[model samples]
Target: MGVAKKSIEEIVQAIGGKENINKASHCVTRLRFSLKDESVVDTETLEEVDLVKGSFSANGQYQVIIGQGTVDKAYKVLLEVTGLQESSKAEVKDEANEKLNPFQKLVKLLGDIFIPILPAIVTAGLLLGLNNILIGEGVFYDGKSVIDVHTQWKGFSEIVNLIANTAFTFLPGLIGWSAVKRFGGSPLLGIVLGLMLIHPNLMNANEALQQDVLPQWDLFGLGVNQIGYQGQVLPVLFAAWLLAFLEKWLRKIVPDSIQLLVVAPVALLVTGFAAFIFIGPVMLTVGTAVTDGVMAIFGNLGGAAGFIYAGINSLLVVTGMHHPFIALDLQLIAAVGMTYLWPVRVMSNIAQGSAALAMMFVTKKKTLKGTALTSSISAFLGVTEPAMFGINIRFKFPFVFAMIGAAFAGMIVAMNNVEGTIGIGGLPAFLNISPNFWSVYFLATVMAIVIPFILTLVYAKVKHKDL
Candidate 1:
């Protein structure tokens, strides 16, 4: 028999529905629920519903993984059935209650693990990318200037660079903390391991190896390379997780009398060496492979590639898969000195932003109108989360039209050979275009904005009646 199509009311009842749900939200792939209490709902029963992908309780909230398009549908049903609205109140609840939803739990966990460290990353990336641009443009002599690095006017640049460089410098530490949290270990120990990797002596040794100078350094007959381990990913994170797992097992075997000293030393030594020899290389290789594949595909496609790339890229951003691709693109730009992805990315962001703006003008609901307004502004600032999650995903057809509009603009830009030299993409990426092609770049940027804006307005006008 076909699975029963549970009405919103029945599904709500199964999941401990109330006259009004206190808060509701979603993650990349889950419809998260924070109800008054867990005892009222039958989570297992809710999972049996046809529309529900899967349901589970984690942290403190009930999470229903509803896939991509389904999350918006489920969110709509939730809002309609429960007569509840999303707002700031939903985000300020007790940690215990917040954890009930797996999406919320993951967000909280990732936040706790990464938020303290993100400033450094953002700063480093901005500085490094900007530095490359300045140096390329001959704005600074030999990529260093008293004014560029130390002056008061350069405070913004210095702060950003410091953050980026520091983050990269202590990357292992960041990974260690995240890995420890992921593996349920003592996060501090992971950070300690990260610090150990970036020690000065180790960095000096790595420099020697790069010069093919064999240094007289051996521990247990294994040659040690002094490599600077800042700004690196993969290895430290893998090592931290590996150490956490080993520590968990060792704790069971070692007697309490000497467990602390013996188990910790063994776990750290084994994991640290493993990271240097195996995990780091493996991660680097994977990142390289993914980047190479994307580049190869993009290179082979030529002028027409932008259409498919822009359309799919917009969809990925809306679905939260854009980050991985963006990460790879940035790495490629850093390594190869050019990028093809930014033209498409910039167009897509503006397209979505324009769509949100259009939605603001047409939507009668004050709540949605406000959300659209905020989201559109956020997108202009290169923060698309508000636009994608708050407006585009909910309004549906507007996003589709936006993608179509972006693809059209992107194709024209690509055909004109519009490219960005900088690592950062989005609206700001226009500044990174080569001056020789400024005329073409300006046209591309205008097209990116206008095409999407016009299409979005037309789509919203036509679709408004249906909605």
Candidate 2:
């Protein structure tokens, strides 16, 4: 219990104490501290605090990257020990506006855009896995494939699909809603806009691209393609931002007497035209280019790309900026039938779990050990933030070891050419794996876990006199 408190106090003191602090806030895995002055920050000492995985300055704030679950505890203590009032994320953002570089602002924007729809995405992923599990030749507890052996269960399966499809099929609408709300527009309006993008009359974006379904509308005087953004991500997010801008401007220009009637209508018409004409087509190109680049790296560079991907995947998880890549994953699956990223994701998640578990055995501190055990389980279950920020990350060696573990796992997976056909990753995501590649994936998972655990355990024993 006191371990977290002790850690929080050390964190506060090492960051130049209460007087240097201007504001403090936190996200899923980082304690965001806005210091009155950055020069006073003791980065060296902050690193030495065993509870802190690492510290870095970003977005005009001195962000101490901590993991989930335990972060909440540390945050409360951060306020209490510093004797400072807790601050809202918005307040912290406003004060630290000067601190945010373009990259940091982009990161913050991504967090805003994705956080709202993350649950839906994760749920959709799990549902995808569940659907795969229930229908496959390797279906848990049965030897039957859904199509061949479980034909009678088609009715039940359709119901399952209905439940599953709700999120993924209408993903654009969901993203639209989330993005619109994030941009300070009416959430309902955003959702309505989103659903409108997928109206039955319009041609689906994927279908139009594939030419399997013909376009319903071609612009009268221009050659621009017109299609609905069904599963397209960037188009909708960009659309939401554009919608907010238009809506706000309309509110300013339109009179109150007829504002309700004309404002939404004009905003949607102009925004929709812009979206279908330019934003949708342009971002779709960007998405394609990114997908090609990621695939080329993995395809051409092999193990090197794997090593890089696996290592950075953990860091991306740190900042909650992994959402953008979800679009890439979808594209990869569409292009190559399997995404190389999922295998690395599995390695990153499992290795963190392994390191946290290793910490449990080697650390003499009871609270950290207990937290390690709990967080390790959480990591294994596909939530890495707790194990990462709390245990593996705090003990710097564990995080490094986990990175090493991910690198080696990536190498093995790449060499084996492991891939997943679905938009899922982490532990049970292997459940979504096709039958032929299971053995290779199993070995990669083992490598990811065992290597990091042993390395971190050895480092702990060599360094800790208490152990």
Q: Supply every candidate's count of residue pairs whose N, Cα or C atoms clash at under 3 angstroms.
A: 14, 4
Candidate 2 clash pair list: 53-393, 60-99, 67-389, 68-385
lDDT score, candidate 2, position 55: 67
Query: Across residues 115-146, which tens digit of lDDT does each residue of candidate 1 receive?
Result: 45555554555566564444343334554554
Model 2: ten consecutive residues of lowest lDDT: 329-338
All-Cα superposition RMSD per candidate: 9.4, 3.8
Candidate 1: which stretches are off by over 4 Å?
1-31, 34-117, 126-163, 203-230, 291-309, 317-319, 326-346, 364-368, 408-445, 462-467
The candidate maximizing lDDT is 2
Which candidate wins on TM-score?
2
Worst 10 residues of 1 by lDDT: 131-140
Candidate 2 yields a Cα-based lDDT of 0.76
Look at candidate 2 and tell me the lDDT of residue 201: 81
